[model samples]
Target: MSDTPLLDQLESGPWPSFVKDLKRVAARKPAAKDLLKQLDRSYKDKITHWKHGGIVGVLGYGSGIIGRYSDLPDEFPGVEHFHTIRVNQPSGWFYTTQALRDLCDIWDRHGSSILNVHGSTGDMIFLGTTTDELEPTFAELTAKGWDLGGSGSAMRTPSCCVGKARCEYSCYDTMDFCYEMTQEFQFDMHRPSFPYKFKIKCSGCPNDCVAAVARADLSVIGVWKDDIRIDQAAVAAYHAGEIKPRGGGSPYAKLDVKADVTDLCPTACMSFDGKKLAIDNKNCNHCMHCISLMPQALRVGTDTGATLLLGSHAPILEGAQMSWVIVPFTEMEPPYDNIKELIANIHEWWSENGKNRERVGELMLRLGMRNFFKSVGLEPPSQTVRTPRANPFFFWHAEDFEAEAAGRKYIKI
Candidate 1:
């Protein structure tokens, strides 16, 4: 009974998809039914009827509503006043089953029973609500310990991986840090007073389980300053029990390290004799690949900290960019004022000079790193390495060069 034969096949897959759920909802809800019909029409015509609603928000709030409107209002009256609500997610996305059920119940009562678990900015996306219900819905949700996430030009929800709580590889408390930041920046999160939406994401370690390094405006990645802890006995046990050689003449067999942990080190910082393994602490990048392979044999270093990367974003005005190392290391401890100061400085600088709707990464691209560093009052460190450094020429400030020439050391901030 549907023209979308190929789209229907998507419902038959082993995994459950939102499409199937939407279709099911469509069977009961008139708005959902119209939405499906409109979507189908849009697909066939290669166009959409939805348009952005200018300056839409809840009472006393200037951000957090992406307005959805149907141009074919007469044909799809049910979808005429549809809007999306982005609710800030809990740190590490850890929600009790009861909490989720309660949230679903709330949405079912106030709006269409459609939801997106996590939006691109790490918010719990509640789809399909009218303008009239917005304030009441927000009030009820706030009463129940829920808050709206950021939209337009404001600090978005800070997301993090489940560190220390579950993963042994975690070098820091990512969830706690994320929660701290969310609470501390409440004013910034609720207000739309920035050049563009800013996102912060935390990873337990450089494994980047949440893809923070590639997508976040500011990325906090856990790291260690000292050598990885290794248990020689456990290493030997693992080697004896799990390490095996491929008998057949396979290409991979020739290059396999077998149980030798030294050969598995991508940086070649490790060396193994017949009985023991030695690692060059200075050379280890803390990739955790070797540790992942032999978890029982090795652990993270004692002096744990975080590496801050900046200016990562998806394709927009300037294009997609992977965040670059800004602060190579910062001690992540209680009352993280240093990180807060750094965030404030970055935001202030960007808000002053950035164009409307321009992301931090785009501004960085437009204005060189040197200018950004100067504005933020940070000296370019030796560790700073930009991607695609094809043309090796770099501009040095005359004052800095003179100071260096005079044998006066420039202190890094």
Candidate 2:
């Protein structure tokens, strides 16, 4: 592993990767070095499939990742198995030196040396672990005050911004909520009782560093119902290009950066009254478009929390859709019962009727919003599920209107 050319190739890049991290272990462990070489060679040979085992469980009450590899004998080597394990991370990512070293020590003892600190998805992914080592490794991890995260078809590990715990922009306690939700959905996570995977994401403010938009099956984003707090000093700094906005969304549109703010302001929220920034609450979408570009000047107010959105399906199911705010904005309570119940209801409904490969959003579409609401016992809100496929093309009103409209239409037949 010490002499592996791939390690040198990887080290030349911008930053370190899991492969590079594993090289440290590879230096001492011949098995790790052999594994890396095998992987490198496999890539060169265009090896596609990796095979492994089943019934893998993690330690404690609620922690572990379970996977089933594609059992195509002709396509894969007998030793190559495609499986991942979830190592629970420290809250707020505040890791002690001792704790960190202890974790690596245990991994060396039981599983593979490679560690994915965090890729786009939130879990601390451990690649290439055997099925037999699963339970014992989990036991050791939990014994050392760590557990597992979501893997397989279960609900994925929920993540949040480094909230009030670290970040100043945090309006709500995002960390507590993330941990609470993890505990709340333990059964749903450890047990594969759903049609497909579920994911949840929370952020301190609109500055969604976690990429909740594309990743989560359900997104809980923070917003303020009140006006943007204008810090004149901060705005001046931003206009001078000394500061940047904290939230996600259209950044250039805010702080009159586009130069069109003097004309038809996109949100009509910003108007320059002789070098002074004015915000109109009614037209604002709470997108933080302005706040982002001019961070010092525009800040989300104290009277703020989160909005729940749905319709996030992976590429396999369909393109991700933005779900409407069913429960518009709720207080971030300790237990988070309201949000938990809503999530549970959705899971229950999906589990009962969804086909093997069907996504929650697809199921909602197929069953109709009216029926979905009825079954869930949720009152239909203003935002109905957008029926992309079901539309006027296949819809007819009553008996005569369709025929009359068709007859009146200019047809060459």
Candidate 3:
């Protein structure tokens, strides 16, 4: 009889089976075998065989290792003391071949040899290891210039997209920013200072290749405050179907001027009269949609900056919510002092007032944006002119209108 009969049943369909891989690993590893047995038992009982609650980690570190154990240790001896480890990845996700080899050699020596690539918090996920192996593994990793990523109530490893390194649309040096932020907050990342976990992600532009807006607690998205740069000749080329829309990513053979470009502008700030493409730079919202579609014709403005947003969290205590803009724009330069000061101040406030396990986003929701921003010394930026209420909802304050004012006139919004 198959040892993992119920687990084997999962291989019936055409889809690739993790059960197959587990079985393969089980050939030489008792933990993998026990893991399969526990899974088969789970299939029969419809419940997990693992339970949490073990405070285990390397010396002098508060997080980065999560301990787990089997409820039936006698039935699954190999997985009795299995724990997960979060090895931090470098900025820009860069790794030399030797560095990767060093990681693999250490894991193979002291752990289950199971590994997962970059996690949401940007860590090399080492799946399973025993308590005995934890210290040795951490020691070896540190010797190789590697360290554990964050877990529990700590600052997570900061992540960023491949920025000025390769992508032309990148408005800032994301790699540099990520590296600096990591170095500056290594203490918080390892020491567990916050009431809950805090995460930061850098997106070179609103293309947001890292999805920072939807995921990170603090989303730093690149923006340009100046007018979008236009090349009339390139616009004519696209209009004459001499260029492909969206460059290599385009599925369309020709640029659909109305369908793809001007009409799709969030603020309707662009117009193409067949011969000429005109943009009302004053009304432009810097959406980046038109620029993405007509890359040859349009480019981001020269006045590069970043937009800071707060309160984004993945579905946990509360369901997933997108971040809201905090700083509409701020000029960025090397050793970003202004943003760093702002972050430090936020940490001071959040660490003081945030409840256990309450995300910063949730705090913003509970306290109301006004109260939260008031505590942090900020105000709501102007909202979009067209139906800002249902959309980003800038009509959040009664102060949005004066005490005795009859009506409001919005110019830039």
Candidate 4:
């Protein structure tokens, strides 16, 4: 019963999130006004629950559909007013001042000024609007050549790490693939028919600059069949104290002679020459660090592309895991039809067999990767999938139904 407002009660703590946003919108948005009023009344009345206006959705778009909430029974305050839209971001994020201004002008016309630069999964999140405005907004966007992306239960937006355009470590073109997949998988992004969420990410190297290991369902990584690049001049620069390693997240803890980066070189491409270095293309791992560290002296070869790794979902499906090269490397040349075809194969497989709330990783685990491979009609590649458990459960094609003991024997071990 104190004089302090209910908003103050909710906003007093460290994660005073709603309060922070409300403060910014209070003067302009009537919806913010209603939100504060509802919170205050709920606090004073000690009410803890509210109901939603019956399920509402966008006409053509699916998933990213959100529910509407209300405090008053049978009354949806500004039912005509709530809207959410997603804006795609440019790869590498280099925005011109004019581009920024143009984007703002569009938002001011169709949405509230408040904008979340990027959503938790990394797409521009815009909030606030009316139901009546959706089609109009979408029409305007399409006419301006802008399009919507996935949200809600559909496939989320695809993301990529800085690649060939900026980073020296890039063995493949990440931006090209990201944009290509964005256009090719329009159905997945626009519709909602997945067991759970699907995410795609591309990285310039094994370093996983985009955190695809933790977030994405399918991860595409740049790799090469060749060896690592070594520049004696660059290694000398490091020794001479002229070059400094900046990114703290080096895969190798500390580059010392013992690290044997040269010996461990996948392509045996790197060798130290009397404190100098040399790169033999025949054996480079395409790990990119040595080249990234010495851009002037080292670089990836042309003919480089990416490997499509699959079934890397969040811990829910399996413990935190990285994707495995299910399809090995493919040509990432412009007009990425190969990548698109692969995506179609995966979606068809999932839609036919997956159950609700079951992620692709979980589906693979239950059906056995061998069955998944056979069903997808793709030839299995060596080292395609890695299992932490050395001896996992499996069923053999030769086993007979009468041999119950044999089936149970593998389980006993």
Candidate 5:
């Protein structure tokens, strides 16, 4: 039935794989069949038939569609004008069964049946559509309360964890914040006016369920400033094995307080007293390990806000980066102007100075973090710490050295 024996063997596994599903689809869909043939040919020849078609998109929108063309158009006629459509997903990726069915019904009518639930940037990626189908497809989707996500040099879709709705460790309402931002920054999402793509991701707590600090250009992580609230009776119960942990595990059965929580603390701020556990809140870094281990005994502090981390991105020019602390804490109330203004300022600075195709993190690395702060009119806070380094590579500034030579106090910038 198939010429590609090795490719066919990939379908033998018990677990469902995309390759198997593609083969199944190929049996019924001409496009899929051609696609499989082309794939086999490419594997045999050690090459591909895909090529980029420069800058094709729907009317009024400058981004979102990634144009792809097949070189073997005669052989793969159905895939000749294949294009990708990015559908903006709801915050936390929560969807009802009816909503999913509705989305599938709309897509089934428009283009190829292939779909990617959450692409790299967390958008609902619809694969393989044609240029002629773009407008009508977009219109129908919009009529059904769906819209295109961002691409190219625009702000991509914002993602978040199901905060207060599902996670007990959530410090703030991440889902609501994500929705609010998506609605507010509609223009930024649809328009391409930046040096490169910008992305935002929010995590409910420092557990960082969504990996926001490592992935997003701008990251908002929920945090607590005050002391962790301790239920002394619950702490006693946990120690005595009278109750279970939050997720139905035997309480303190496998817990080694010295190894798990206290030793693991970055600042060594936790200590278990004879009667109850106590934490040195001053030294606590707001790492969520203790809260995760003892959910019943510990809850987040009342003074909750979001920490803003800036310039995180996957490697392109510089390297993979974890976001640096920009604003350590900012109130995240409804009508989040404080957060919006900060983002706007960062965008303005990056747009004015960034080179073509350079990410925000790469720009910061090239221009120096000091210049970035000064350009954006932000004072460097004491909380700003460098990413962990294995090697020491520190250099004193010329001005600071000059001041030191002159026997005056060299105040660092």
Candidate 6:
């Protein structure tokens, strides 16, 4: 009989199955075998039998190693304390062969040997390990120059896309910035002292491969504020179909220079007269549509920088929100003092006003952005909102209106 009859059903499908991998792990790790049994019971019962215990880690850190112990420990003794071990991955998830080998070797020695490529928040996740094994496992990884990611109410591990390493469109060195950010905020990452978790993600350009705008609390995306540099000859090549649109990835049957490039522009600022191309640079929104289609012809402005957006989060307290512009554009020079100051100010404000378990975004929502902007010393721009709220909401206190007008005709409430 199959150990996991229900789980084996998943294997029959065309896609590869984790159940198959679990069975493989079960062969060597007793914990995995029992885990399968517990899962079978879970399928039959339709209820969770796992409970969060006093999980701990090696680095004298109290968080990051997340686990839920089996409630039916007597029945599934081998899988009693399967904790998740989160390793702080390198920027862009780039790892050499030796590094991967080392991690696999450590997992084989002390863990269930099941691992995730990376988690949504950007940590390289080891799926199964005992609480006692965490210390030894992390010790070996650290010796090989790796560390733990964040969890609980602290800042989560920061991440960045592969910028200069491979991407030609990179406006800044995203990996370096992300690395420095990780280092600068080490204390926050290790210590669980925030009202809620915080995430920071960087993208080399507005391509946003890291989904920074939608996923990060603090989204740093590369941008250019000046004119789009245009090369006439390259533009002619693209217009003539001599150069394929994004190397032949367009949905259009034939590359229609007008339909694909000029007309589709959000600002409608591009014009091509067959052999000649013209762009109204001042009207350009830097949407990257044209630049992406004709990379050789249209290049990002020389005055490259990054845009700062804040308060974006997944649906939990508030609905899923994309980041809004905080700073429209700023040169992200090394020793990034501009960003450092803003972050310090934000943290200081949030630490004082944020409620227990409330996200910084929720805090801003509660207090209202006007007051929040005043407290943080930020100039709220039109770019802050896609469109001005038709119905504006505010939180006015007793002192917001004059004491003399309390009973008068002027109604502040």
Clash count (model 4, backbone only):
10
Q: Estimate each model's TM-score.
A: 0.90, 0.79, 0.89, 0.76, 0.90, 0.90
Which one wins by lDDT: 1 or 2? 1
lDDT string for model 4 (210-277, tens) is 87766688888887665444456766665454555433344543344214446666666566754867
Q: Evaluate all candidate structures by whole-model CA lDDT and list the values in order.
A: 0.82, 0.67, 0.84, 0.67, 0.83, 0.83
Model 4 alpha-carbon drift over 4 Å, by segment: 1-22, 33-55, 63-65, 68-81, 91-94, 247-274, 277-303, 315-319, 392-395, 399-413
lDDT of 3 by residue, 290-334 (tens): 888889888998889898888788755557888878898888798
Which 10 consecutive residues of model 5 have the lowest summed lDDT?
245-254
Error of 3 at 170 (Å): 0.9
- Alpha-carbon RMSD of each model: 3.9, 7.1, 4.1, 6.3, 3.3, 4.4
lDDT of 6 by residue, 1-413 (tens): 97568887888999998888889889889989988888988998898878764646666785578876899999999878888888998998899998999999999998988889899989988877787888888889889999999988888999999988998778888998898888888888888888888889999888888999999889999988888888988777776677777756766434677878899999998887777778888888878898888777888887898999888887664579788787888898888877877877887788889988777777777887776777778887767765667658654556656644665543322
Q: Cα RMSD for candidate 5?
A: 3.3
Question: Candidate 1 vs candidate 3: which has greater lDDT?
Answer: 3
| Clashing residue pairs, backbone N/CA/C < 3 A, model 3 | none
**Residue pair clashes in candidate 5:** none
lDDT against true structure, model 6: 0.83
Error of 5 at 365 (Å): 1.6
lDDT of 2 at 303: 89
Candidate 5 residues lying further than 4 Å off, grouped into runs, are 1-3, 242-246, 249-253, 387-413
